[model samples]
Target: MRWRCVTGGLLVVMGLAVVHAALEHDEPIIGVDLDGNLFINTSSSADGHTRRLLLNGVDVLRELTELRQKCAGNVPRTTTTAPSTVAASTAMPVSYTGTVGCQLESVPSNVTHLFGNVSLSFCPLLTAESLKVFNELVYVSGDLKIELNTNLTNVDGLGSITSVGDSFFINSNDALINVAGVGNITSVGGDVDIRYNEALVNVDGLGSITSVGGYLSIFSNPVLDNVDGLRSITDVGGYLSIRANAALTNVDGLGSITIVRGYLGIYGNDALTNVDGLGNITSVEGTLHICSNSQLDTSTVPESVRSLGTCQVITSENCMTC
Candidate 1:
């Protein structure tokens, strides 16, 4: 067996290895991962482990007896808590990380407490007054990519950006029409990509973005008509692709988005007719891809998004029962 081909060549030159022991003190060291996977650590100061793994002959004692009846219906019923009147010096203050960037008079007049990540496309002699020296940067913590600035037009000179912490990419800027210079940015932990700005029309300075922990793409902006400035978004934890905006008519500023954990693509807008402003989106954990809008009318999709889930309103010949 040649030691099982030298122990599978030391498990392919040493890759997977997760061992944490602690026996005699009450035996419980289950870490078996060899294509079988079976890590168990409910914690006694061992390490984290929620519960998931037992495929291929699953029946681990009848799935631990249905996971102890779903962990006794998720125990924890002994409450008595009341302690949090806010006040941690009124919170806020946690910026400053590192890496600023270059050019625009080679910034760094103490960079106003500069925080991390700000790739202003490495200054290909960026103008618009070199973004008014990043308006004396207020915060960025991470990601604020402004790519391929082909004579970037209106960024309103980075209107003293508020916060970014992660995602805010503006790609292929061919004379950007508006960013209103970070319009008093409210929140954006990640994903807010505005792609191919072919002279963007309206985002009216991002109308003070409300929330977007991830995903909110507006691709190929060809004279974007109206996102109604994202009307104080109500939550978009992920996925909300509005593709190829070619004069998008109205999404009625998303009519106060009512949550979109993921998937909700309205593709190829050619003057979109009605998403009925997403009629207070009830839910869409995934798949609600309304395709190629040619004056959409998938019954004006948004009867709370077809009862909340899987909908592929396809190729618009005016959404003939797609």
Candidate 2:
């Protein structure tokens, strides 16, 4: 009878014949079978048999750990007689509607979702201190447009938002500097447009975003340097455009992206010298445009991207092999 307990990324395996020995009351039995099905035995049946419950494969260990932590202590656990009633009672939705003003007092707290399209533009009074009201915002159900807010320096109050249901635009903000406030956002259901911001330096705050359901345009930010903050993005459902960022030096932050559903455009970036970050990209459904980068070594374009799926390759006016 062999018993193996694995934590973290590895799976825990237990001999099927010795299942009973691993099902002690104090020991929560969790294991994968020969057929690759994950199961957990939390309670024993009246007939002295261990009743196993199948679990979804997603983050199984983390879920199990959380369950154990919640069941700890002197808190009483109640069995639900009607699961539908209990779920309905606990799943009450909280939402906010309409455009949000620059004033912190105009926004409500503890709201899980914002319903209508929200725009914070041309508000001279908007600053980091007045944006604290957005700390409780978890999701935006519509487009979030923040543009031309001269007084807004940082996006500190938007740290709590994890997802956006539609497009996200941040453009032409003269005084904007740090964008690390939006670091928690993991997904954008539509386009993510960040351009024309003069004071913005780096996009490190957008590191958590994994996917973009639509186009991702990052262009014309004159002082913007490295795009290291976009390292976590894996796929773009539409076009991926990075153009005219005069101060950008490398595309190293875009190393993780594997697919671009639309055109992959990298042009007019005066200071760009390295495109090695685009080495991992496996597919570009549209045209692959790489041109007008004076310092870039065109020969450095990875061989893996040379023959991407049904795309026309356009490379010209770079330093070499153009």
Candidate 3:
């Protein structure tokens, strides 16, 4: 059981190699799918080990380095692999709507572009080390989809992914206990949906992202306990929904997240006590639901909660009925 102590507020900096050093092969990096998506795996080892099948073999992940080098190192092939219209020096501008395996050393600041979307169902093996270097490893000009594959029990390398410019879909990243990359991303030109990652426990890195030009959805992350970084949001052109997080207790950090053009729904969360972080929301063109959390106790809620705009707070069980 290795305990990785990251520096204060610096989410997702572990190099792929660094995360590999922290991995314990006896653990399975891939997890069981909590939902029906065969591609969604969200289990992890509570003992604090990182596990994944990076290569054909399990654990040591020796081949990951080789594979990453191969996939990410694809500059324009001199001979031409796609077509006469496609540049002989590059991969055709095509977005793979299916799972594309990747072995990359580092995500480069520059990229190999062929205009199209790339869809990837999370492969069984990827550590924080590899994920941190993702921007320097793979090259994509359009959308990129990474559906959490199964059985993840740790939050090791998750904080490393910093950007998804276009539509980025990450569903069921269960067993994930930390969210570190949210600090580094300045914008998401497309929709950003993070749904059903059941084990998520913290929102440590999201303080840096000031805007989401598209939709912002966070649903079904049961173990999630905080929403501290959601303070700077002033506008979201699309829907903003937060549902089901069974153990979630609060939605602080947003004295300014009061205005939205679309629906704003927060329901089903059992432990939530307050929505004080909700600033001065005056109007919602769509529906707004903040109901059904049975155990919420407003008296016990943290002081971090800012605005109490029209909030129907849930009183604690011991309150005297006047």
Candidate 4:
């Protein structure tokens, strides 16, 4: 033992041999910029309740080596997925392996496209519970093609739920009808295109929010009566159309708005009486047709726009170029 101590002393003095050694790989420590390329060795006891801390460099390396040697092959070294904690009806924490916060480069080759299957029906809508009502369906991967909206989706047939997240996709739903109770949503990251929803009626609830990213069109919502929520929006990057909303009545919230490139078409809103909101509109890039509104009145329109556009009514004598 005295000879062994002498040999250890000589090794320490030489700096070539030590009782412990650093591991092969260095992992990136994640946080808000505090790591200086260093991490101390840390672990909990067998029960995993109490932790033991080891200091810098060689001593840590040695203790870890001893742990590995003592356990032989029991140390877990790798994980195929990101960390995720799920809550279910059981209301207890259940840990499962799944890729969540991984960036584009971190994704595995097995996953080519993220949201693979575009199913029509949202067959089983995910609900919130006591400890974990998901306030966000966020995607931190930094991909523009994908969206992370928890409060973004609105459903209506059965007193429909309009949970607000980011922005939920239409997902190619065809034979769908009626989105009623979905008025609580107040924010949209992108455009809100309420197209191809044939049986949709009275989309009056989406009024709480005040911004949108892209074009805002209310096309083909055949029975939609009023664009009440859209009244506050003052800017649009693309076209702002109320085209083909046959039953739409008022464009009230668009009071302070002005469009640049796209047309302001109110082609077939058969019941629209006043384009009263267009008084402050200073310019238009395309046609501002209030044609075939059958019930429209030119008295509310400014005289400058009277000659630039035509007006129509159900009565032949009060119709066209009014």
Candidate 1 vs 4: which has more lDDT:
1
Per-residue CA lDDT of model 2 for 1-322, tens digit only, reads 2223333332344334333333335555667899999776556655687544333323334555655554454355688775565444564446888767555575666666888776888888888887777777889988878899888889998999999999989999998986899999999999999999999999999999999999999999999998888899999999999999999989999999999999888888989887888899988998777888888777887777777646544465742231
lDDT of each: 0.73, 0.80, 0.54, 0.45
Where does model 3 exceed 4 Å of error? 1-118, 132-141, 151-163, 296-322
Candidate with more favorable, higher TM-score: 1 or 2: 2
TM-score of each: 0.30, 0.68, 0.53, 0.44
Show the colliding residue pairs in model 2: none
Write the residue-wise lDDT of candidate 3 on 141-171 in tens digits: 4565656755544433333334555776667
Q: lDDT score, residue 178, model 4?
A: 36
Off by over 4 Å in 2: 1-94, 101-105, 318-322
Which of the numbered candidates is closest to the native, going by highest TM-score? 2
The whole-model C-alpha lDDT of candidate 3 against the native structure comes to 0.54
Candidate 3 lDDT at 226 equals: 70
Q: lDDT by residue for model 4 over 215-262, one digit each (tens)?
A: 567776676677765665666645567766777777765675655245
- Residue 305 error for model 2, in Å? 1.8
| lDDT for predicted candidate 1 compared with the true structure | 0.73
